[model samples]
Target: KINKGGQLSMKESGEKDKNECHGGDSRFMAMTLKRGRKKKALEYLLKKEESTVKAMVDLKKKYA
Candidate 1:
């Protein structure tokens, strides 16, 4: 298990922060759906979708 803010640098912490953001967004979507805020949830989903797509495109370009 990773230590809590041990010797990791800011870059490492930033990566963890991004992962938490993604996870939190996913949980928020589920909660929004449960509350019948489907539209808002979908909007939030699109932002994630956009970010994922951009990441994928960058990865492809990097390897291709």
Candidate 2:
């Protein structure tokens, strides 16, 4: 799925009942910067950080 800017969604699903999402946040930022979209990249980075934090919290809860 593409977002509003025609960017590919980072969300994905796996065969083994696992949801596999790419770490495309940084890559997306890189691409945006290359295209001279610094502000957009920064916004994406913020959202990416939130997602990372949520993932970390989930992992900790599962393992701890």
Candidate 1: clashing pairs of residues: none
lDDT by candidate, in order shown: 0.43, 0.45
- Cα lDDT tens digits, model 2, 1-64, are 5443234444545232122233333334445566766576556555554655354334334433
Native-referenced Cα lDDT, model 2: 0.45
Task: Quote the positional error of residue 33 for candidate 2 in Å.
Answer: 0.6
Q: lDDT tens string, model 1, 2-56?
A: 2232211223434554434444443444455667675765565455546443543
TM-score of 1: 0.40
Best by lDDT: 2
- Give the poorly placed runs of model 2, Cα more than 4 Å off: 1-23, 50-64
Alpha-carbon RMSD of each model: 10.9, 12.1
Question: Against the true structure, what is each candidate's TM-score?
Answer: 0.40, 0.37
